[model samples]
Target chain A: MKAAKIVFGLLAVTFLMAPLVTILPLAFTSSDLLSYPIRSFSLRWFEELMISDAWRMSIVNSLVIGAGATLLATVLGTLVSLGLRRSFAFSGILKSALLLPMVVPAVILGVGMQITFIQLGLVNTHVGVIIAHTVVALPFVIVSVSGSLAGIDMRVERAAMSLGANPLRVFGHVTLPLMLPGVLSGAVLAFATSLDEVVLTLFVAGPNQRTLARQMFSSIRENISPAIAAAAFVIIVGTVVVAGLVLLFRAAAQRQKPSTVTV
Target chain B: MTASMATSRASGRGSTTGRDGSMAASSARVAAMNGASAPFIALEQVEMMFGTHRVVDQLDLTITRGEFVSLLGPSGSGKTTILMLLAGFLQPTAGSICLGGKRIDHLPPHRRDMGVVFQNYALFPHMSVADNVAFPLRMRRVGREEIEQRVTRALDMVQLQHLRDRRPAMLSGGQQQRIALARALVFEPSVVLMDEPLGALDKQLREQMQLDIRDLHRRLGLTIVFVTHDQGEALTMSDRIAVFNRGRIEQIGSPTEIYDRPASRFVAEFIGETNLMAGKVTTTGPDGSLIRLDSGEDMAASAADWPAAGNEALLSVRPENVTVQPVGTARRTERVNIMQAKVADSVYQGDHLRLHLDCGQRRMIARLDRQVADYAVGTQVDVVFQADNCRVIPT
Candidate 1:
């Protein structure tokens, strides 16, 4: 039975890893077109991804949009979580309404936002795309921040107040520091959401405002450029590095935590 | 939903004072005459409401300057609520709070300048002991050098100077409690409020800390308001205790006055172990009163405050005050109230032997010194109650 379970686990891992195996090696091929079985190894496609203005501009757009969306989502989500933490008559309903964007289908939201952006004359603007990304990214921030907020014992805040801290000072000194880990994780999630976003960008973005995901989608459909494989490899490696940094940062924070003393 | 909120608000300041506001004023006047020039902290007709529930109603308390007063009660008896109100965390629905002859009800928590030691310690996990103690001074914008000096002095006062660089979680429970105390005192606020600060420590540690805190109270001459449910802690640490029952101050006096001359039945029962007998006042006099017990025994007792004759009364006798003697040893006299009782159970405590007696329809416990002859269960005994030791309170 144990051997059968091991075989099942390996099969699951292989199924999930099949696409990466098929695509990763193609980026190293010498051929201009992304064809299967390797002809020869070359660094031409990676060089193309770096040197091409269009590709570089798309990467810059993705970064700009991701940072803007992340800032907007983290600030608003944290405020909403804190406000909802206090008991109020409508707090439960308000939380569900704020999370509605996550439940709605992305295609429907994209179409709706496209129409709204056109009427507002924001269809070609970075602001339009960033706002759209923030809407989808908000739920992740709220969920993460709310968990941390709930974990905090409110008596600590009361203790601060008793120790001569005003409300704003208490938030700046105590609440914010305690919730930093959750806020950082939420911001990273928001940035990732915006970087990988394609459907919403396709509907609302102009050629000058195209994100890296949108650029890759067009490359796959129109030309199957080997540069696309190189871009995908970069994205995969970048995500891993970002995630590893977050883990390392969290571990450092954990180490700074006070150890319980034995009598 | 609104109804529930209203209900909670009312219940939060829940209990009504049976004797009314005038009684509180009289008590405050009495406290003011206890050698203090003026009342340091005065709560006048304070009422707290959570929705429609009254958690604290028409409450008035007075604490003298440099005196350590403890609010003693069971859980949900509004002792903690009173502390929160004093700390400016909860606003009174009606009436005013004054500190040092100035009204402070309108001031915010930080502006009030009162320090509070919370039940759980509530030390910041991110800061070291010295940093935690320095926080209040930092908020007040004290000079950097002054902050360091004060923080060092406070840590030294708690004998925790070596651990100043350590975080609170790195300390034992007793050590953490001392850190909390030092942090609260480092700012030198006029009044300090403590809500069961020693409740989390072990018995030995709690006793040690109690003495430590009492020493601090004396050397610093600080006016402190302490809240606790433990009667023993209140008795040991408080110069005076305000015994609360259902959010109302049932009585407030010195520990001996509360133990030996309780103002009400609740005070007598709550403060210590007692044998209570239901009776009626048969006669009233300047020196004492006569009561007829429900079990058909007529007992003479002293009453500081007389209830009208024929009114229902409760006879309160401390277990230690009741004397258990051999059946024929007592020289029966009218001056001594005696009863024929059977020893239903005799418990051998370390310093004393406790005899649970069955006297016909009533039960009484007598705590006898260990030097007395041991009375086994089912032994016949004569219980003697001196008139001076028994108090008659209107029920």
Candidate 2:
């Protein structure tokens, strides 16, 4: 039974990693075109990617836009989660509306944002793309932060207040520190969301603001060069590095967690 | 509100005739009121409403400085609500609260300078014990050196100074309780409110903590409002106990007064074990009264605050007070109130043997000495009740 379970798990993992496994080896091909057959293994496509200004500029834009979107989404989502902690008549509706972004179709959101940004004179700009990415990333931040917030005993806040810490101080000292794990994970999720965003960037971003994903999209449509495969490899490696660092930090934090004191 | 307020207060009055009765209770209360320079905390007609559902209704109480008073009640009886109201977590919809002769209901919890030890301790998990105790001091912007000194002193009070560097999650239940107590007391707020602070511990530990808290209360001269549903804990630690029912305080008196002469049926049933028999008042005097039970048995009981002679009454007697004498040839003549009963069952309980007896159509139980041989079922026995132990409560 255990062997069967292990076999099924391996099958699931293989299914998930199949795309990455197929795309990763093309970057090592000697031929200019991305195909199965390779004349020889070479670093020519990587060199091409490094020398091209468009690819380098796209990487920088992606980083800048991702950071900006993450900052905006994390702040807004955290504030919303905190506000939602206190119950009110319309809180249910408000929470549902805020979380609606997570379920909305990306193409619909992209088209809606495009039309809205055009009238607001924010079209073809970094700010437009960042805002679009933030709209999508905000739901992840809210869900993660609210989960952490819900885990905290509300009485702890009251205890803080009774112990002479005002509301602001209570948040600064107790609530924020307790919710750090959630906030960190949420910020990382927002960053990843912004980095991987392409459909919204295509609708709103200009030539000057083309992100790495947008450049990759254009490269796929224009040509089947192995440089695109090289870019894919870099993107995959970069994502793995970021996620690995986050998981390592989380594990360290979990190790420091004290044993249960039932009292 | 005024009418209910009068009833709540009157329930504690006019019952000065128990073994440890009214005179001492009134004196203790009077001493508490005049003992301090002023009543440290006063709640006047405090009404708390959650939406339309009233949680606390026109509750009026005054706690003198340095007094240890307990609010005792079952769950949802509004005792904890009063503590939260005093701590400024819940706002009273209609009344005023004053601390140190100044109105404080308008102030937020932090500004009110009241400390609370939560039922679960609520100690900050991320902080070391010293930091947890220093949190209040830090918020008040106390000097770093002073905070260090006071933290040491607070931990020392709870005998937890050696565990100062340990995190709360690493401590035992008792140690965590002490840390929570230390944190609450470090700031030395005007009043300390503890909500079932010892409820989580085992029985033995709870008893030890009860004594420890009472000792600290005396030594530190702290004005404490303790909330607990455990009647024994309240009786052990409190100078006075306010018994609450529904959303109002049913009675408030010293522990002995509450136990010996409970004001109402609720207090009698809630405080201790009592065998209550429905009766009608037949004769009343200054010292005692005579009641005829619904079972047609006549019983002599201590005088209670009854409306009239023929009105309904409840005769409550503790099991320990009911002596069971085996039916014999001559020894039963000296007993004043005696009735023939058949032993339904008898169980040995280490220190005492409980005799469950049936007298006519009524079933009663008596807690007898362990030295007495157990009476077998269906054996005839004589159950005696002294007038001092039998209390007649007016309905």
Winning candidate number (DockQ): 2
Model 1, span B1-395: residue lDDT tens: 11111211111011112112121111221332345456778999999888888889799988886667999999988999999999998999998999889999888888888889999999987788888999999999999898998887788788998987788778999999999998898888888899999999999999999998876665555678999999999999887899998879999988899999888988998999999999998987867778999988999887545778889998889999899888988865545788899999989899898999999989999999989988889999899989889888878
Native contacts kept (model 2): 0.55
- Candidate 1's docking class is acceptable
Which stretch of 10 consecutive residues in model 2 chain B shows the poorest summed lDDT? Answer: B1-10
> For every model in order, what is the iRMS?
5.6, 5.6
Model 2 lDDT tens row, A81-156: 9999888999999999999988888899889999999999999888988899999999999998898888788888
How close is each model in CA RMSD to the real structure?
8.8, 6.9
Error of 1 at A186 (Å): 1.1
Positional deviation of B189 in candidate 1, in angstroms?
A: 0.8
Q: Give the TM-scores of the predictions, in the order they appear.
A: 0.91, 0.92
Q: Against the native chain B, what TM-score does each candidate's chain B reach?
A: 0.90, 0.89
For candidate 2, the per-residue lDDT at A79 reads 94
